[model samples]
Target: MQELEKKEFERLLPYLYKRKERCPTFVFAVLERFIPGFVFADDLNSPKTIFVGTDSGLYFVGGPISNVAFNKHFLKFCSSKLKEGRRFTLFSGSGGWDGLISDCFRLELKQSSRYSFTFHPEEYGVKEVQLQEPFTVSRLDEATIRSSHEFNLEYYERFWGSAGHFLDKGFGYSVIDGETALAGECTSIFRGKVYAEIDIYVDAEYRGMGVAKKAAQAFIDHCLKNEMIPCWDCNVENLASRKLADRLGFREPSSYSIFVKNQ
Candidate 1:
């Protein structure tokens, strides 16, 4: 198992989930590989694997992209992290979800619009209103996507491989227009586990017509189709984002802040 230190791994976040509009790339961006981003069972030939923490839920990567397996200390760590209100922990083959890991988690929240825990499928009484019309989303190839910005070369280099890496693990994206993109709310996960940490953007010119919401619902539907839970998490202070989540039926499980151990 290879661990990606938080500091070095976070720097590669931006390009991973790029958009011309608002998106949820915060937690998954840099923290994707924070503590135990990648790990494998003792069976070296079992499968190459990785795990990522998202604002909403945990993600897996492996055997080409990444996969989310179990880890030994997962339940113990989940217990510790949860002593507080909100937190995330990844589990590799070290633990089991049903016997032990399940003890540390609830049913990962059902898709509801009860903003206190979720923001989808249901609401006070009615469902959420649409935010925008959906458009096809896609990943900009590294060479092509690289030409779009000039923040860091190393970042783009990692991106060239990440789409394939993440895609193989069930992550996907679509083109908002032709150039811009509306990325994953996660499409597949083998089980009826609808999970998606949707943080996407609508181009400035495309705002006010429900571009973001439209694309997000589309992504959410993708999760539903696969039976994966689609979820969203945002800073309580991010009123706009919070409202958007509520509008889309993503309820807040709780709110908390992350402190940089060194910062």
Candidate 2:
């Protein structure tokens, strides 16, 4: 497999579009150069398979499932990267791809299901959330993010590379109680071309207080105003996340598999 440069990244778009399901936003983040990642294909000129790796995870698209040489090369590449201490989780959209990866990896791998949801603005309507005194909803600015001792700050840096980049390319909201951020919802993966996948966190002490819902509503409002499609993804077993997405009018749950190192 050959690593394709950023300019060559677009060549894989046709393959991505061929998939029936929505492509993961992280894949677009890499292709758009919004974040650092690598793209590889079986052939530069006439590719049969494509692979994308990012700090978040790995994705595979395109095929000739029987390409033994490319499969071996892919396995060797993954082994080397894993040995180098990179925690790469393989995301598979179809059972065929899941089976392919399972057969190739000799190491113990754990499997999990992730659910993807699409937002329906009509269903959500224009409801407003009112917070009591001492609690407020605020846009996620650099200052607020920097001052936050919660997950929001680390999320931007880890996923978007830095707060500056996140500010320029993405947006979010947080619910604060007094001087502390109680909950936050932000763009976990965004590609201006289409969707913005949300990521949310609520302080343990503040769970079930509607703080997370408030933050998420504000985030969704921004996405609607900007004409960007809002998307939600979570582990299938995360009932809280699934319920929140449903409450937010995100419908059509689709299941996909992700393989991670057994730990």
Off by over 4 Å in 1: 1-120, 124-161, 178-194, 261-263
Name the TM-score of candidate 1: 0.43
Error of 1 at 8 (Å): 26
Residues 1-263, candidate 2: write the lDDT tens digits. Answer: 78899899888777666667777888877887777788888888877677787765565444655777777777787777667665668777577778877776646667789999989999897467677778888777877777666645676777777788888887778787888655554544556456677878787777887887888888888888888788899999999999989999999999988888877
Best-performing candidate as measured by TM-score: 2
lDDT of each: 0.40, 0.76
TM-score of each: 0.43, 0.88
What overall lDDT, based on C-alpha atoms, would model 1 receive against the true structure? 0.40
Q: Over the stretch 1-263, how does candidate 1's per-residue lDDT look in tens digits? A: 43455555544334333422222222343245321233222223332333344433343221222222345443344555555555343322222222333443545422112122454465623343343345454433443333333212343223322334334443433334454443222221121122345545444566666555655656666666777566565545667667777776666455322221111
Candidate 2 regions exceeding 4 Å error are 43-48, 55-64, 179-181, 189-192
